[model samples]
Target: MTERKRVIQTGWNLENSYARLPKSFFNIIKPNPVSSPKLIILNYSLATSLGLNGQALQSNDGIAVLAGNQVPKGTLPLAQAYAGHQFGHFTMLGDGRAMLIGEQVMPSGERVDIQLKGSGKTPYSRGGDGRAALGPMLREYIISEAMHALGIGTTRSLAVVTTGEFVVRENQQLGAIMTRVAASHLRVGTFQYVSKWGTAMDLRALADYTLQRHFPAVDAGGNQYLFLLREVIKRQATLIAKWQLIGFIHGVMNTDNMAISGETIDYGPCAFMDTYDPETVFSSIDIHGRYAYGNQPHIAEWNLARFAETLLPLLHVNQDQAVKLAQEAISDFTKLYHYNWLTGMRAKLGIFNEEVQDEELIEGLLSLMQKYHSDYTNTFLSLTFDTRWDVALFGSTEFAHWYELWQERLGRQKEQKASSHQLMRSSNPALIPRNHQVEAALEAAVKQGDYSVMERLLDVLKDPYAHSTEQIDYATLPAISNRPYRTFCGT
Candidate 1:
């Protein structure tokens, strides 16, 4: 196919995803339209990666598709069916407000689900308006793109479109739709959705289909079921570790929000920590700190248990036998998550081999950071700089004491001693999407119709570890009055 053909919609062969499913699992429906549509942000890189036209995706035709203006040919826009345990409570939640517009098979032979979040309701809408507010839409667009740039596996925002209408949140806010592209929209909750109302045959069919589509190699070995769980565990471990290393708080860790692919999915009320606090909580809904910074690892384990419960019936014949197998598999989460987290943390601090005292050495630095309330991203970035002068940013005399231990620890490792430090410097970013910067970018867009700042922020974030004198200002944390930033649901 020629380059231009990539932008054209060819109707999907639904048999690949929908043909094998029982009708009770999903209610097929078209997307509901909003009042008016206007493009907010276009992720051309993500579009091009999926063998889509970068030019067309940024064009009116592409924006129309993203804004739910025109359902592309061969697409089936339906809100997926799934049930999730929200904040430890089981709730019958289905897409709620998001609608999936069929799937795309990429040049690399990967099938991706192209979904429009905030594209209005379905039978799953419950009692809501099926709309998304402008703030959260823009937030997902910025953060998801930023995460992708960081080399962490994450859903990409193909486009963000304003509905040119208002919705009631804390107050009236503009409505918008986010074109979210992902490996698959299948979540652990999807299994729960099917299992709750589906028969044994239906659940088995869903499991078999998932194995074929996402874990095909396992299917050939007659261990597809076990293999699928293993793969999901590894992905979630690595994904959660990446988030923690970068000081990202997912804010909500509901079972329904967990992606089977393990990429970071929902971006609601999510925020990066300006100051490293294990107890940091950003979501307005997380009033009791259920999904706090330090609690994520445990929460991920909890979610995996929910996933295990849904898969138990398919794992073994008897309930006790099934529970035994599920528990054995779920138990791997802690070691896997900590291994990934510790290894990444070691690299960030320039350590390699584990020492009996290394745990203290690492924990000591974090304690110092908490004592001084240091900027998590910046402190790590500064360590990768030429000299250790920037260590003062930690705001503690103890920081100097800790640096001595760090330097001594570095003496034991031989990977990059001097040169690898440069590599580490590059791997560690000097800038992130600061809460203030994102807010400023949105303010510029909403008030003045200017996206120049947003574009500029994306540019800086793309080369996060580089030292750009021109954009050095973007590297600094805002003053206290400017910080403790709070995000909203945006309806």
Candidate 2:
């Protein structure tokens, strides 16, 4: 490529809508350049969706831009200011090492945030190195893509770039940066920041901007801020339900980590469950299991309650009436969450129609799985494909009775067996980002600098619902070890 061509950043189509907000909301800053930038992985599929030429993005200039060594034109990079209740402790926080470069307007006219994570420190570094490690960046890439393939709403990884520098953590780790794409970077914590520090006008402006950007469909005529809380509550209800259905433990559901867009935001200390244990805790710091596999729904409600608190002023002129409105919205969260979760569980079980006893039947199967330690993802896969698995567990007489009940439940529906099977196959993925497999892939890429394993893993994970033979190897469970699997907040 000619010097002139390389200098001209291609396919950016950027819009600085968020930067136009009040100065206190963000800091217009540029990324701290890295010495040498190398391409790790480029998401061509996602790139195409954003109207970017993947081939061009693989070029030297592209790698530089991704590594934060170069900023593309039309990009007014800014580090957003926000605060959060992390692990239930309120604190001030912001994009300490991340930058929201700009929004990319897709062919469909949808605007998405294109942020480079682990780029460098900003005004919110909090006296720490604003750098990221290769393992965590790749972890986010693998798991986020896996979540997308599994039909979950999540932030997408655009690319991962390795900076030829080391970051000091537990040990010296290779530093890297991740290109993340999201509907918007607005979070519940954004509201918290304005509510705590900014004036009521700032809070209202943030709420209005969030509604216009994300929940545009909501009627804005009356009590729109209240509607904003309701819309977010509903999205979060369904989002958490999806997370539960897939046995995903976010490990950290702090207010800052909860995106107002309802997309799964940070992948820190996040992992999928191998066994059917409700109290599974993977994050090393989550000793109390506040964000455990089963506690996600309640935690989501808690986060939404915090969000509702931020909107109390705008919800009504009277604090009492506002509290009532917020309480009503939060009260509906449990019903909405249960309804969404039950619907998802029914789909996973191949139940065409819900029955009054469906929850009982589902609970019975889960209890059996918990007692037998059946693999979560594969259990559903076995039910979907009629494949023999963990015969010792499936061969139990109690399981046989549950299977009979499930069959009877399915028979009640007018849908054919094939249609029911199809629903189950789609709802229950043939593969998930198994904890061991992800570790192996990350180990290979991080320590050995061999991305082939991760590449192969991503290839199969791209179509998690296919139930193809290629996924079997990826689907197999890891050997049981006495040591528990632990994930760290690789920030």
Best by lDDT: 2
Local accuracy by lDDT, each model: 0.79, 0.91
Writing each residue's lDDT as its tens digit, candidate 1 over 273-321 gives: 9888999998888889999999999999888888888888888788899
TM-score of candidate 2 against the unseen true structure: 0.98
Q: Pick the candidate with the highest TM-score.
A: 2
- For 1-491, candidate 2 gives per-residue lDDT tens digits of 65446534457777899987778999988779999888889999899999887888888877877988877766789999999999999999999999898899988899999999999999999987889999999999999999998889999999999899999999999999999999998999998999999998888788879888987887757888888888899899989999999999999999999998889999999999999999999999999999999899999999999999998999999999999999999999999999999999999988877689999999999999999999998999899989878787799999999989998888899999999999998899989999999999999998898999999999999999888899989988998799999999996
lDDT of 1 at 359: 70
Give the total clashing residue pairs for model 1.
2
**Candidate 1: misplaced stretches above 4 Å?**
1-16, 58-60, 386-397
